[model samples]
Structure formats: C-alpha cells, structure tokens
Target: MIKLSGVIITFNEERNIEKCLQSLVNVVDEIVVVDSFSTDNTKRICLKYNVKFIEQKFLGYIEQKNFALGHASNNVIVSLDGDEALSEELQESIITLKSNWQFDGYYCNRFNNFCGQWIKHSDWYPNKKLRVFDKRFAEWKGINPHDEIVLKDHRKAGKLKGDILHWTYQSYSEFNAKTEYFSTIAAQAYFEKGKKAPFYKLIWNPFWAFFKAYFLRLGFLDGNNGYIISKETGKITYLKYKKLRKLYSNN
Candidate 1:
C-alpha cells in the first residue's frame, strides 16, 4: 500500500483547521502543516491534531506550497488549503488510491460554501483542482495569485470521485473584502507577466464575467446566492483590470 501524506498551508485558520484535520484523520498516513506564523490559536489547534507543524514565512501561493511539499513524508501528497476539507466520498476514493496507486495526479471537484449555503452554480461548483499528486511527478507553477500543480505532463492525470468542501466565506462582507484583495494580487501578477489590459478588459471583461457565471454557467438556477456570486464576480473582474490598468499606466 502506498503511504499518503496530507499537506496544508495555514496562517490564521484556527476556525477551519480542526474540521479539516478531522476529515483527514483516517485517510492519510501523515499530516503536515506549514504554518505562516499566525499570531492566533492556529498553532495550538494544530498541536491538538499532533500534525507535523513547521513554521514557515508566508511566500506566494506557489512558493509556500512547494515549500510544504518538501516537508511531506510520503510520495503521494494530498495538498489542501486550511479552509478546505475532504468530503466523505473523496476520502474513500483517496483511500482506495492509497492501496492501488494508478495515476500521477488526481484532480477533484471543489464545491465552495458561501455565506450559509453550498454554492452549486455561480461559476463556483466543480472548481477542479489538482490537489492530490505524486511529489516526484509534479511541481506547482503559475503566478503569485494563481498556482497550478502542473504534472510532468498533463496526460498523466486522473479524476477523483467527490468534492473538496471549501469554506470560502463566513459573511458577505468578508467575501467582498477578499474579492478586493484577490483582485489586486491577480492584477499585479498579470502586469508582471507582461499582460496588458485593453479597453475591453476594463469594460467587456466584467460583463462577460457576469454573463459566464449567471447565464452560460446557469448560475440563475441556483437562486439568490447565485446572483450575488455572479455580481461579485463582475466586480472582481472590474477591479482586476482596473488595477492592471493602473499598473500599466504607471509603469
């Protein structure tokens, strides 16, 4: 049987870490947490789980995760964010893979919980992420705000059965706050990568962002939460390009 290690990166994730750890208790042989020196109860809670907790400075998403992978004991590493938990079905699927390792990496659907409901539409559901992978075969890449676990080759991959439950936002206000923060990061990353914001990006991109989520992705069917999500997505798109334009004009 292949020994699987679960790795996570955290800052102030005390609220979610316990539940996240609970879900992985039986699925992974070892649990490793690379904490970004949070000045909260996060470290204490991690201690309760007896996970291999290593304090690391907060780098960009890709760097921090790659650093975490170096600390993982097993070849089959399941990387999860502190705010994410494995669903029961996903846990079972990973367990099966532990006994019969078949693929170089496993992609799973991630369902985000916003406010109080599990969002099914809103360009949120089935947010496929490559969370489980063989350390020797894949490396995390992408700009600062976005990171992807690019396998040695995309062909050496497989999909898993269930979703990774993402506890995204506790309130609308918090969601909005994060949206602004993420947009800045995304915009800066784009600018650094020599991506220019055309006039259409500032206007058309936001409209298409909403349209893609609300209509093309059938977000309207998910009801009020869906509309709210789509609207927020539009705002995020606007902010990203606005920031990008600012960077472009300044530089």
Candidate 2:
C-alpha cells in the first residue's frame, strides 16, 4: 500500500479541527496541520492528536496551501480543509486507492452542512473538488477564497464515491462573518487579475443566483435549509461585486 500524508491549512479552527482530524485518523500515515497563528485553542487541539502542528504566517489561501504541501512528508497527499471531514465510505475508498494508486488525483463530491441541515441542491451538492492528489502532478492555484488544485495534465484525475462532509457553519453568524471575509479576498483577487464584472452582473447576478439555486436547481426540495442557502448565495454574490466596485472606484 502507498503511504499517504494529510495536509491542512487552518486559522482559528478550534471547533472543527478535532472532528476533521478524527475522520482522517486511520487513512493517513502522517498528518500535518499548518496554522496561521490562531489566537484560539486550535493549536491545543491539534497537539492532542498525533498531528504535526506548525505555525506559519498567513499568506493568501493558495500560497498558504502550497506552503503546507511543501511540508508534507509524502507525495500522496490528501489535502483537506480544517472544516471538512471524510465520510466512512470515502475513507474506505481512499484506503483502497492507496493500495492501487491508479490516478494522479481523486476528486470527491463535498456535501455541505449549513445551519444544521445537509444541502443537496442549489449548486451545492456534488460540489466537486480535487482534494486527493499526487503532489508532483498538481499544485494549488487560483486566488483567495477560490483556490483549486491545478494538475499539470488532466489525465491524472479520478473520482471517489461518498461525500466529504463539510461542516460549513456552526451558526448563521459564523456564515455571515466568513462570507464578508471571503468576499473581500475574492474581490481583491479579481481586481488583481484585471477581471471586471459588468454593471448588469452587479444587479442581475444576484437575481439569477437566487433563481438558479432556488427554482432551477430544485432547492425548494430542501425546504427551509434550501431557502437559507439561496439567501446566503445571493448575499455572497452581492458582496463580491460590491467589493469589486469598490476596487474599481478606488483605482
């Protein structure tokens, strides 16, 4: 079997870190948590586990993730967020993959939990992410709040069954707070890349965002949780462009 290393970048993730690590406990040969000097008890929790905890300055998301990758002891990397955990079936699939090692990376569907309910629609379910990858084949790329694993060649991609359970929000307050922070990063990232959304998108996108998520995507099936998800999605879109407009006006 191929030995695997788990890597994660975190800051003030005290509530989720333990659960995240717990899900990874048996699957990884080594676990490394690169923290950005969290003021909370995040460090204390990581220290309790067999994880190798390292403190680092917070760069942007992509840079911080790449930094953590560099510190991984193995080339077979399972990159997880501090807020995400593997499901039992997914864990089993990964263990099987380690033995076979067929592809350069494995993409998994992440099922997000928002406000204590599992979101199945609204462009939320099967939110594909390439979390398990060979370090030599792929590198973290893209801007803050939207980084992705960019593979040198697309041939090295595979898929896994079962979802990666993402404990996205402990409370609505947390969700709102994070959206504000992420919107800032996203806007700055877009500004730096010379990408600009037209004025129509500033208004129309939020409406379409709700329409696509709620009606078209059958978010109504999810009931109240779906409504909340759609509401937040619209807010994020509004904030992203609002910040972008700020950048444009300032410049």
Candidate 3:
C-alpha cells in the first residue's frame, strides 16, 4: 500500500480544526498543519493529536496551501481546509485507493453546511473540488481565496466516490462577513493582475449571478437560506467588480 500525507492551512480555526483533524488522522500516513499563528485555542486543540503543526505568517491562500504541500512527507497529497472534513464514504474510498492507486488525481463533490444545516441545493451543491492528488502532477492555482488544484499538462483526473463535508457558515452575519472579505481579496488579486472591471461587468454580472444561482442552479429548492445565498452571490459579484473599479480609479 502506498502512503499518503494530509495537509491543511489554517488561521484562527479553533472552532473547526479538531473535527478536520479527527477525520484525517486515521485516513493518512501523516498529517501536517500549517497555521498562521492563530491567537486562539487552535494550537491547544491540535496538540491533542499527533500532527506536525508549524506556524507561519498569513500568506495568500494559494501560496500558503502550496507551502503546506511542501511539508507533506508523501508525494500523494490529501488537502483540506481547516473547515472541511472527509465524509465516511470518502474515507473508505481513499483507503481503497491506497492499495491500488490509479490516475494522477482524484476529484470529489463537496457538501456544504450553512448555518447549522446541510445545504442540498443552491450554488452550493454538487460543488466539485480536486483535493486529492500527486504533488508532482498538480499545483494550487487561481485568485486569492478561491484557489484550486490543477494538474500539469492537462492530465486527466478520476472521480472519487464520496463528498467532502464543509461547514461553511454558522450564521448570516458570518456568511456576509466572509463574502465581503472574499470579494475584497478577489478584487485586490484581480487588480494586481492588471484585470480591469469594465462598466458592463458591474451592471450585468451581478444580475446573472443571482439568476443563475436561483433559477439555473436551483437555489430556491433550499428555501430561505437558498434565497439568501443566491442574493449574497449576486452581492459578491457586484462588490468584487465595484471594489476593483475603485482600485483602478484611485491609482
């Protein structure tokens, strides 16, 4: 059987770190956590388990995740956020893969829990993520706060059978707060990349974001939270471009 290393990057994740570690400890040969020197109980909780926890200052999401990958002892990497955990079925599927590894990477669907409820529909369900992979074949890429693992040379990846459980938001305030934070980060990243936010995008993209999520993605099926989520998605779209536009104007 081949060994696998689990890696995670965290900051002030005291509320969620333990569960993330619990789900990973028995699944991988070793677990490595790269934290941003959280001034919370996060350090105390992680010490309860047998994991290699290292402190680093906050780097951009993609950079920090790549940094965590470097500390992994095994080339085969299972990456998760501090708020994510492997489902039971995914755990079994991964255990099976250890004995007969195939393909360069594995992609899995993520089920998100919002405000203490499991979201079955909306812009959240069927959330596909490529989290398990061989480090040699893939790297983390994309804008800050929205990074993804991509394989080099367009190599084909296989699907794993199970979902990743993500506790995304605990309250409306938290959701809104994160949306504001992520939109600002995304805008800054875009601005730095010399991407412009044209007037047309600011006008139409927000509406499309709402319509697509509520109607096309079936956000209404999730009821109140879905409506709120769809609207928030639109807000994020509007704010991202709005912020980006401001950045260009000020310069």
TM-score of 3: 0.98
Score residue 183 of candidate 3 by CA lDDT. 98
Which digits, one per residue and each the tens of the lDDT, describe model 2 over residues 16-84? 989899989999999999999999999999999999899999998999999999999999999999999
TM-scores of all candidate predictions against the true structure = 0.97, 0.96, 0.98
lDDT of each: 0.91, 0.90, 0.93
Candidate No. with top TM-score = 3
Candidate 3, pairs of clashing residues? none
Model 3 CA deviation exceeding 4 Å by range: none
Residue runs of model 2 more than 4 Å from their true location after superposition: none
Alpha-carbon error at 17 in model 1, in Å? Answer: 0.7
- All predictions: root-mean-square deviation over Cα? 1.1, 1.3, 0.8
> What is the descending TM-score order?
3, 1, 2
Global lDDT of model 2: 0.90
